[model samples]
Target: MHNGKPVVLVVEDSPIIRMGAVDLVLLAGYEALEARDADEAIRILESRADIDLVFTDVQMPGTMDGLKLSHYIRDRWPPVKLIVASGNAILEESSLPAGSRFFPKPYNDHSILDAMARMLAS
Candidate 1:
């Protein structure tokens, strides 16, 4: 946690979507960190131990996509929660890291916030 608030890393290749996710995270009372792609997100994750959760988009221009990133995080930072989103890809439940949640594009802000709250609470 950062400054007594949960720290969430929002990873999206699209600037607009990243900004919107950051806004939602901040509005939900978490400290928001932004990354344009999986590589950047990995750098941040490596440097920060206070991050409580990751909110990432599936499609990205990077060495690894969000699915791979999620798997990496699960293996390396097991304590962190994950919320993965994708507009086009149809992900299977088994494809996600254990305990991670998935949401399609145009996900509800309220629902995301609620999920974050529940994940953080647990």
Candidate 2:
């Protein structure tokens, strides 16, 4: 946690969506950080040890998309939680690492917030 609050990294390529996600993270009462793509996300993850969760968009312009990013995070930082979303695809639970949550596009903010809280609480 950062400053006694859980830290969440929001990863998305679109500025508008990224901003909204960051706002949601703040609304959920956690510290928020952002990255536009997998590479930048990796850099941020590598540089910070306090990040407790990652909320990422599935499609992005980068070496790897959010799915790959999530797996990478799970492999390298096993304690970090993941929440993956996509407008274009609905991934099965098996596709994501264990304990990760998936949300469809236009997902309810309250639901996502609840999921974050639940995941962090575990």
Candidate 3:
């Protein structure tokens, strides 16, 4: 934790989207980490144990998509909270890993922040 705040890792291939996420995370008083794709995100996860949550975007340019990354995290790092977002993909609630949440693209900032707060509080 950076300065006693929760750490949130954002994995998104698009620079624009990632920047937006980072802004929101910072505004919400969390430490933010950025990864361009699932592979980079995995490396960060492997190297850092301080991350309290992960916010990832689907349809990244990598071998593993956000769904697979979520599953991998659930299996390998069950303590980490997950928030998955997608613009084009239609995902069922059952498809997400246990304890994970989903947001459609152009997500509401308030809702996302509320969800993160709830997840971290739990």
Candidate 4:
């Protein structure tokens, strides 16, 4: 956590989407960090321990996509929460890491915020 607020790292290859996600994070009263792809997201995760959550895009131009990244995080950092999104694919809940959440692209902002709040509270 940062300054008593949850720290959220948003990973998206699209600048506009990333910015919107970051804004949503800030709007929800969390500190926001950003990465363009899973690789960068992993780097940030490696460099920080205070991050409470990760918000990631599925399809990205990196060695690993958000799905892989989510599983990796679940394995390497079990305490970190995860939210995965995609415009191109819809995944089954069992496909994601246990305890992680997923949303299709064009997700509802309120729903995202609500999910974040609940996840962090837990």
- Tell me the tens digit of each residue's lDDT in model 2 across 10-112: 9999999999999999988899999999999999999999999999999999799999999999999999999999999999999999999999998899999
Q: What TM-score would every model get versus the actual structure?
A: 0.98, 0.98, 0.98, 0.99
Off by over 4 Å in 3: none
Lowest summed-lDDT stretch of 10 residues in model 3? 56-65
What are the per-residue Cα lDDT tens digits for candidate 3 across 1-118? 7689999999999999999999999999999999999999999999999999999998889899999999999999999999999999978989999999999998999999999999
Q: Which residue pairs overlap in candidate 2's backbone?
A: none
Local distance difference test, candidate 1? 0.95
lDDT of 1 by residue, 38-114 (tens): 99999999999999999999999979999999999999999999999999997998999999999999899989999
Best by lDDT: 2
lDDT of 2 at 96: 98
User: What are the lDDT scores of the predictions, listed in order?
Assistant: 0.95, 0.96, 0.95, 0.96
Please give the distance, in angstroms, between residue 33's alpha carbon in candidate 2 and its true position after superposition.
Answer: 0.2
The TM-score, computed over Cα atoms with residue i paired to residue i, of candidate 4 is: 0.99
Candidate 2 ranges beyond 4 A from true positions: none
